[model samples]
Each structure stands twice: as structure tokens, then as C-alpha cells.
Target: MQTWLVQHQKLLSQQLAQGRLAHAILLAGVAGAGKLSLANWLVQVVLCRQVQKNNDQGILSPCNSCKACRLYHQGSYPDFLSVTSDSKNIGVDDIRRISAFVETTAHLGKNKIVLLPMAEKMTTAAANALLKTLEEPGLSCVLILVSDDLDMLLPTITSRCRLYDIRPLSGQALLESLNRGQTQENLFANVSQLPELTDEQVHEQFRQFTARLLDFIIKRQNRGALLALLNENTYAFRWLEYMLVTMARSQYNWLSWSALRVKLVTAEGKSAATGAAPGDAIGQLPDSETIWQIYQLVVGCIKQLKSMVQVNAAYLSEKLLVDIETRLDK
Candidate 1:
């Protein structure tokens, strides 16, 4: 468990100890915040026949040797149901399957757990189908819904479950956590604007890609650099969108994750050459209106990428870079 989840784990432990655990729990947080991990941990606790409680800290944990825990670890737990969407949305059939699972008896004489990893992806009919089961779940059934955006869920679905909001750790804490076992050079290299990235190599690559994109934008030239970066990474559109948003926030003197990342990257480069303290070069970004216009342009390109008809990525990227240069010229 990460340090960020310690408090939530303790709270849920207390509820379990008192036999007051809710039948349905809605775990809400941004992507990569470990909401799914927390839900899985909670399921193990609820299903474990031998749950251990530390007298000193009063933390609850599952005993791995228990039959229920063993089955879960082996991925052969009959009572556990994990639901996910294959298409754009989880249709009513998915919810109906969950309902059927809930109606069955637990095979391990423990709580039957049904986990929906992306609850927000459920269609309206699917959500409606889940309402009645959430209201009156089986005596030993637990439903856990994990969502990156709680607002996308139906009000009736959210209102029926106990909501637990998870948050990212502070910048310093997060840096320390992510930098464990990493050298100083690699530590700074791996810093990212993303809220969370579990893989160090992927994080570092993303940072590098973002840096190149930022260099082109800040210089208001370097069309070649922009094209090179886009050609090398499939996630160029996402990086461009992030850069535009950061520039917009910088104009308002607001410090977003991307804005902070921009400052860090710029400061590192400047400090290496001039021997001066790192400063906020992000404040030199273009005006807010200009940034918004560029952002909308990137947004449109992203939608086009998602269209049914195939679009040439290289051509689209070049066109976007040209449009951005034009905007900067004005």
C-alpha cells in the first residue's frame, strides 16, 4: 500500500471492525491514483476468513494463508466478479450478469465481491439495471465501483453508494515516493506532469517528449523539432494539449501540474548553463486568449484522431504545427 492510502485503509478497517461496512462503495479519484488497487485490497479484507488487526496501529489486513485469500491470489475465486467494458460503453448485459452473480451464494462462505473498474463507462440502461441491486445487495455481497470521473455516473447510482474520494499525495511526498531507488539524474528525468505513472521508463519518456514540445512552443519557431517530436511519439496530441493548458494557466499565474513541470524543465536547462537559480520562465507564455485558441485547435485534432475514418497522423500533426505557428505570428 502507498502512504497515501494508509488513512483510507485505516478508516475502512474501523468500519469493518464495527460491522458497519457499506454494501456498496464508490471509489472516486483521478486516473493512476490507485483507486483500483485500493478496491482490490478492500475486497481481500472482506473475503478473508483470517483478517489480522495490528494492536498498535489498529490496521486491518488479509491473511494470505486463508483459503479465501489463497483462492483470490490464484485468480480462481468463484465468488469474485470483475466487470469491464469491451466497447465504448458497458451495456445492460454487463449489469444483468452482475445481478445474476449477486443472486448466487458465496462459494467460500465469505463475502461475494463484484468490482466494476470503470463504473463511469456504463451506459444509462446498465446504470439503471444496477440501481436495485445496490439498494438491497445480498447479505454477504460487496459491490465496489471505481471511477476516474464520478460526474459521468448517474446521480441515482452515486447516491446509493458510500462515496470515498481518493487524492494524490503532495508534490514533495510524491517525488520522494517515485524517486525511491532512483539516482539524482534519473529522478529529475522521470518527473512528469501526469498525476501518476507507475512505470519509470514510460514516465521519463513522456517527460522528454513534453520537453521537446515545450521547447518548440516557447521558441515560437523550430517547426522541425515539433515535427520530429510528433513523429517519434504516438502521444504527441496529448502532450500538445497538456502544453497548451499549462501555457493558459501560466498566463493567469496559476500553478497546475503541467505548469509546474514546465517550470522545472526550463529551470533545469537554464541552471546548467548560467549557474543561476532556476526561475519561472512559464510566466513568459503567450496571452490567455491565444493559448485558449491553440488549445481548442488541439482539441479538434484529438477528436479527429478518434473518428471512425482513418486519419494520417503525420499530416495532421504537421497541419497543427503550421496552425500553431500562424497563431503565434498573429
Candidate 2:
């Protein structure tokens, strides 16, 4: 168990002891809050015929000896259903399958568990389809919704579920806890950049790229070195978007994770104009607005790359770097 989540686990245990655990549970938090882990623990406890108690927090865990536990651990549990998406959106068809699953009886003659990780990824149609299930979650069934950003989810979807807002430790508290000798793997396990940082080589590549980007932004250095690195790495645009996001948050004294996530969704799109405003500092680091503007520009470049249109990626990359330089100098 993550030490930061020990308190949350205790609260959950208290709720379970009082027999007040909601069937439709929504564990909402930012990316690194470990809400998905909590959802997993709850599902294990629900499926276990015999639950074991933790002496520390008095939290309940599954008895791995049980038949249900064995099946679940083996990924062969018939009563358990998870709706996942490889793409950006979870479509209506996925939600319809969930409805079909909820209409059935539990194979274990106990609780049927359904988990929807990143539930906010559900499309408009998917969210609407899920409303029917949320309104009438069948007998002896538990539906768990794990979301990184609650703002992306529809109000109607959230209203039907019991919400537990699990927050991540930030700033000093985060540093203190993580410094207690946590390994790199454990630290990055729940980060949004996991897919990009696959190996040591890739990790070092990003580390250097981040350093160069800071030099370009804060030190007002030439863009030649940065542009070279950007053109080399196919994922450079995403790295810039991610770094600018962090810098933007730090610019605001490390803004709240939830609040930053909201800004990420609501920030303005790419603009036609690219230069800095009149009277803007010639060589100083940009303000918050400029940081977000550059973020949107990078996102635009990424989108263009994803499209079917014939694009000169190297030209696009150079154009973005040039635009950033132009924006830095009024």
C-alpha cells in the first residue's frame, strides 16, 4: 500500500465495516493519486469469500486462498468485467457491453464487479449509455469508476455515483514522502509519461531534452541545439507539451493538480499570430499565458502529425522553434 493512501484505506475500511459501501463508487483524482489501486483493493475485498484484516490500518484485503481470489488473480473471473480503451475515447459500444454485463447474475453467487478505469474518457454517447446502468445498477453488483479528471466527466454520470475525491500529495509533502528511498520505477509507475519513458536510453533522452528546453526558455539561449534534439525525437512535441504544463503550474506556485487539469482542458487552442506582444520582454522567460500558448501550439503540431495529410514534420518542428524564438523576443 502507498503510505499516502493509508488514511484513505482506513476511511474505506470504516465505511465497509458500517455496511455503507456504495455499489456505484467513483474514485476521482489526478493521474498520480493511486485511485486505481484503491479501486483494485476494493474489488478484491468484494470478491473474496473470506477477507483478511490488516493489523496496521485494520483495512480488509482478499484472502488469496479462496476460489474467487484465485480466479481473480488469474484473470479468469467470469463475474468481473473491465471496460478499457486503447484510443482517446471509450465509445457507446463499450458502454453497451457494460450494460449487458450488469444485467447478468454473478457467477460466484456473490457480488459482480465492474471497473471502468479512466472513466472520464467515455464519449458523449458512452456517458449517456452508462446513465441507464448507473440509474439501475443490478442486484449484487458493484460498479467502480476511476477517473483522473473529474471535470471531463458529465454531471449526470457523477451524480449517480458515490464520489470519493482522492488527492495526491503535492510540494513539500510529496517530496518528503517520496524521498524515503522510493525507486525510480515506483515513482514513474503512475505518471502520465510512462508510455514514452520505456527504457533507460529513452529516459536519459528525455532528461537531456528537458534540460535543453529549460535553457532555451529560462536562459534565453539560441534554439539551434533544442531544434536539433526536437527533430531527432519523434515524441519531442509531447515532451514540450508536458514540460510546459509543469512549468506553467510552477509559475503559479505549483497549482493544484485538479485545477491544472482543468486548465489543460480549457486552455485556448493554437492561434494564427505567433510573435510576442508589444513591450513584452525581449529575452526573459515567458509568463503563464505565453507558456500555455506555446503548449497549445505544440499540441497543434502533434495533431497535424497524426492527421493523414502529407506533412513535412521537420519543417513543422523548425517552424515551432522559430515561432517560440519570435515569441520570446518582442
Candidate 2: residue 270 lDDT (0-100): 17
lDDT values of the candidates?
A: 0.74, 0.73
Q: Model 2: runs farther than 4 Å from truth? A: 180-330
Span of 10 residues, lowest total lDDT, candidate 2: 265-274
Per-residue CA lDDT of model 2 for 1-330, tens digit only, reads 667678878887777778888888899976546787898998898788888886776888888989999999999989999889876678899999988997887777887899999897787789999987777834677899998778778899898889998866654455456563343333233345543333466666666676577668766664787889887874577678877877687678675433322222211331101123323332334788888887887888777765523357779888988777777665
TM-score of each: 0.70, 0.66
Report the lDDT of model 2 for residue 136.
Answer: 80
Q: Please write out the lDDT profile of model 1 over residues 66-138, one tens digit for every residue.
A: 8888989999989999998766678889999999998888777677899998898887788989997776634
lDDT for model 2: 0.73
Q: Pick the candidate with the highest lDDT.
A: 1
**C-alpha root-mean-square deviation, each candidate:** 6.9, 10.6
